[model samples]
Target: MGLLDLKAPSQAGTMTEATGQSSALDPGTPQWSVFGQLTSPVTHPWAIVGETILLPLIAVSLGLWLNPDDPLWVHASFPWAWFAPVVLALRYGPLTGIGGAAMLLLVWLALNLVHPAEFPKLFFLGGLILVMVIGEFSSLWLARARRAEAIQRYLDQRLEFLTHQYYLLRLSHDRLEQDLISRPMAMRDALGAMRNHIATEQMDSDSAGASALLRLLAQYCQLEVAALHYLVDERLQTTAIATLGNTSPLQADDPLIEHAMQTGHLCHIAQSLNQSEQSSRYLIAAPLNNLDGECFGLLLVEQMPFFSLQDETLQTINLLLGYYADSLSMHALAAQIRRKEPDCPPEFAFELQRLWHIRQSSQVSSVVVALEIQSRPGMPDVAQQIQRQKRALDENWLIQDVDRSILATLMPLSGQSAAEGYLSRLEMWAHQKSGQTLAELGIFGHILPLDTDPPLALLQRLNEIAHASAQTRPLRPHA
Candidate 1:
């Protein structure tokens, strides 16, 4: 009735070719193929409503032209006018199918006034039942399809993240291969040192670790002279926050710097430029950016060894700067939580902040589970025992006193249900290993899901609850 082929009656007649590809049609089949496009259900509201209205009207009009006396064909061998509603029911489901049926009822009533025919109750009743049956089945299958699409999208994101990480790994390996013999320090060692410096230092301003960061870059990048400048209100500040190896003041209008600013990526002398760089002093310009594409600072290379200026060296600079920017951002966000809980591990705080960002942007969730363990007479520390069971992606922070310990585990990309399942598993493990339940072993569990509250705030609240419980309980004298 809708002009599409009836050969695939099971398939819906809704979307065009583009929608088919987005909805994940078979990879082997071309999107333009009739089977691919027409089979997919229409998700847009206007399209569904339009088709639901138009198809039944077409059927009714055709019926009127063929037989004015019994346009619905109720008295004929077959009630052909009911075809549109049944097809629609199979396509979109019950609500749309029921709408088509209601239209036919209105038409039937109008015909009764003109020709004075009987009610024909059985005809309409049978069509409604058929439509309802087909629509119910369609609804169930459509829900499954939508759920599958969501899962596919999440997997795609994970794959993309892994691919980027793989490229970073390859780049690091290439750098190591090129510099291992000449350079005394490895990239990983330098990175670890930088992370330790960031963890220990107080980030009072945007240029918190500027000097140390520049020194690290100088060591790795073989820079004879360079300067790092922080951005203020989207404009580069003239004064250099950190300078290495006798660098002059930054030139704000340098061609390389302007190019880097315009493109939001690393720019060097070798790159094509519209402006003449004959007067420019800097050899390379790089923006310190995080994964979110926020540029907080700029690195200008005033001088470097001629032979050292290569693709590998430039990529190393870009990668290190990006990593530093991301780390700095995390430290800034985690600083508040760190102040609230001084004993909290910096790694845990940093990860919590990162996960909070991911949750906000992608709606994927992560949870923090706190397990309080009281030292028992015979058994080993339950907190440390649980720490050994940390999952691959989980980060654990264990705080220990003489007689008590609190183990806070951050399960990345997990939800409330996942936390519950983890707790249940831990409870079973405790029973099996210690021959007693969690209660018997003096271990208490609390699940704090990262939700409406900020992650830093949530972690601070967890510390408060833990401290309150510690203060109220009576302490046993140390032996």
Candidate 2:
């Protein structure tokens, strides 16, 4: 992920000048140095040893042949002879340098022994050795300096790229926040205005909530298509809400809707190969849950290619859809409650039971259970036990309050037998896995047959039972 690694080969050409400077400082080959084409292939060690020995030998032999009568020929050739050993040490490192230096010394000693009169004096030979040593050390230092410079340049480039990336991320985050926060506020205000217009009982169905929701979603998300669909008998059925530019209706059994209902999350499809076909575009759906945390409908969206649909975007859509779902549920429950019991206060449980059709079936009873755990005095650890219990239960069934007390959930489809089984499993899990004593944790539940009463009455009864059960627990100080 480094900038240099990401750069295209064509773009890399622009960096040639900088690279050449780096190479010049480098101890290795120069940037513009072209390797000589070999007439014959050379082996590695032979190449190193031969190049070191042969170049100097050639220079000395040529010098001697050209100036056969000159006594100073050998001394004049000495400096040129040192060139091969210096190059060998630079290319192959210190050990090879020492080996090449040893070869030159042996040659020097043999020549002196054979023709002592023609050789330079001992003091001069000592001076020449000192010069060769200095040259070898200087080459090593140059190599190290070049490597350090290359590393520094690499770090500098990385820092620059990261700084640019950071600013881009910040701007993107700020824009996303505005879209998520401000759009919802504006929609809520518009809905409030509409509510005022429909305040009179006679104007109930005049304003379209679903249509307004679709419009707000499309405008905020900049979507190519957006719609709201109600789930009818586990099927995705189109409501009076749609904003597709030219797209067809989504299939009844689309996998996207199933995923949303199953996970209670927003699901998305990013691309498709076919344009003329149905479901050929990116799709996102957020499940709409009522106050009881039951999914009632879904908010669907499809967007153009210009926008990048990220996870945060999906979550924002879900939050806005949840708000709309809550509003619609409140209005529907109020209407249903008034029709059932004109004198009663607004009841959530009763409305839910009616909406879920729990009363007409004999197979099961709908139940909601609330459980509270109080740690014993001087208990070793209670917070850990609470966490264990929370994780053990189904995420949909657990409701966390600011206080440590927890609400255990059961759905409309559950019967008395099934609810009891669930509670038993939960109690066993807490005691066995979390080591929570039964007495320390107070457990209670309320069961209502779906067919027996209106939804509001059922909710009231459940609330009353929950309160009564909490009061029975031994009062203790909060942790």
Candidate 3:
């Protein structure tokens, strides 16, 4: 509220040397004073009041003890009792020092006026005023220094916090790159490279994604040959197979493949777990499951390193293959729907039909939120997070440009305010919750009503927003 209260900070410093701001300044405490525990600045109100009142009382008590017959300063042996007030003024601020000195001056005046003047009143009063002035200067400087230190501590803590967030964000992006793409890179530049890959590789056709996934395995997993199997009519059948590095492509399903398909869990040819005399070549098969937990396909690998057969590696392969299968399933389903309808996509046709009815109703409204990601890669995790947080009535679309970075969500029966609120939440998740700052991301078209805005026009506006979001944006990261 005031300069005096500047001693306190809104929050404590982070876990660093410049930790955080102090709520209050206490001169007696460490780091509170300019010198090591030198000046104890007056903080507590009652402590200063006591010191001011107690000094004057002690002076009066000493005078009365010296002369019981007349308990007045004039009857005492000493004329000047100024040491107590001076010391109090030096330790406390101007208020306490001046108040105590004024009491002593009253005693001095009574003694000199009643009896005789032994000491010059002008000289005595001048000395008291000087001490008060000196004490005030000392206290003022001490307060300023403490306030500065507290502010500095707060800034340092903020810097530390931001540094940690950036480091972790960078690390996650790097790990994502290493896992998603088989290219090794410097830790610092991993995210940028991954972003580039995502911008190019994202929203690829099911065939393209599967092909890339197999290529990745060939490079990183050190597989000589890989095959894909699909579950058709309750039986596993080979769909596609890839070979690399002079390895022969296996057309027939081996016992290893059949066994892996029989059991849903990943199966691998290993010397430690099984001692059967088989070919020295290594083989592994992992099942790709859908949301319903039904096996959709099989991912086969041959001649992989035994060391890479651990649970972590198997899990990673399974997840990647599963994601690839999901893309395949979605694209295949979309094609089927389009062929049957021939007029419009099944979902789009249904939405338009529903919009026709909702248009007549005066109560219902619908809007769209178009988010354009400018910095981070549009990974599956980000989409999954949006899906988890989205409402049942909303339609989430993965619309890709040359630089696949934007996601558009349409509200079928929702107002403008609801759409904007959801946009704010998405911004918060990107910046605060997901550790990806909105500074690099941008929002366009606060809300667009679906009933009023044409579908093609809305898409064009969203595309315009995506282009504009990256051009003019903030780079600041918030906690």
Candidate 4:
């Protein structure tokens, strides 16, 4: 038989459909039969040779024991010996079968010469030739079946791996769509709804604003806890102003909070909570920075089941929290500005002059001197002047507008000579401006004591001196 004889039959039409149904019912049936046949061949070279060699040897020994004096009985008993070559051919394949047959023929001829038997030598030779053809065909068919089975198994494994990879790709695509598109849009809509409540006229105070923000963040982000902490600076002693979460307010030592505060970046802790024991889960902290890029506070949020605190999510949270901080800070600053009820007070003016005189007389290690730019011809716009001054003194001093005519600034932790040098730079800047001369403008300044007074009080004193100086010196024309 050729290699085709070994292959499992491919069913046709209705039979194929039936086979598919049967395979579904019994998955391993085909594989079991294929492997079984490969291991146990019906008739092979080894099997035939082994049996032929053992059978004759046993018969001769039995005959010798039964009749020691019967010479004719021994010669006749070996009549079945001619069949040994045929048996070898049936059990083994063509090459091994032919070799076994040749060996048996030589033995039979030698025995016939020694004690001539009645069997024909041609009969044994003809039987061996027939067995060779049959054995060769059977062995060829078995080898072909093994090859087909191996090929089928290899193809099946490849198909399975491809199917698994396809499903995984689909799952990844769905996750990306949900995370990038859906989640962000949902967050925006939620923020808009919260903004409606915040814009209402009745809502006031930082605490109320913080509470509103926390509620919206929790709802949108699916967080279990959300808290806002305000920075409280009490003469360099910083503390938390308000907390809205169930957990204890975060101390200065908390790593997540400290990192957020220091870097003004978002920080997160994964697997920080125990669900069964009711511990805080994942924590995400975003820093709230001012327009000056100074961190004012932190917004701490915690999630259950540990929601992914990815960079994009953290950035969105930071942006929204920053807006809340800006709005609240603006409201507080406006209120504080309104409470200070003075354009220029006499006592403040006298105190400012006294401080300036003391700094000029004393030889202290460090004194902060500041110049008050009362009037300028080109920039009559106060807002524009403030902006320009801010840009100019971005890193130099702490500047603030006291009133319409005066701008007060502090050169913190500096001395009288340094203050004088700062004043000279201000004079040069004033002279450089178009339509303005240094001598033409009334610019009075003062150096105040860094201790024993608040920055706000010092600012108030400077304002008074600036206003008095402006009144004393008449307005100069553009030069």
Scored by lDDT, the top model is: 1
Better of 1 and 2 by lDDT: 1
In angstroms, give how far residue 51 of model 4 lies from its true place.
99
TM-score of candidate 3 relative to the true fold: 0.36
Q: What is the TM-score of each candidate against the true structure?
A: 0.60, 0.31, 0.36, 0.33
| Worst-scoring 10-residue span by lDDT in model 4 | 3-12
Whole-model lDDT, model 2: 0.49
Prediction 3 global C-alpha lDDT: 0.53
Tens-digit lDDT string for candidate 3 (219-262): 54566666665567777654453334444444444655555555
The residue pairs that clash in candidate 4, if any, are 1-137, 44-91, 44-92, 45-92, 45-93, 366-415, 367-414, 367-415
lDDT for position 113 in model 4: 84
Runs with alpha carbons beyond 4 Å of true place in candidate 3 = 1-208, 238-241, 245-253, 271-282, 294-296, 333-367, 370-417, 420-479
Which has the higher TM-score value, candidate number 2 or candidate number 4? Answer: 4
Output the better candidate (1/3) by lDDT: 1
User: Per-residue CA lDDT of candidate 2, range 346-381, in tens?
Assistant: 223333434355234322235544444433455335
- Cα-based RMSD of the predictions, in order? 11.8, 25.8, 23.8, 35.8
Candidate 4: segments with Cα more than 4 A from true spot: 1-206, 212-269, 273-308, 311-378, 382-404, 449-457, 466-479
Native-vs-model 4 lDDT? 0.47
Rank by lDDT, highest first. Answer: 1, 3, 2, 4
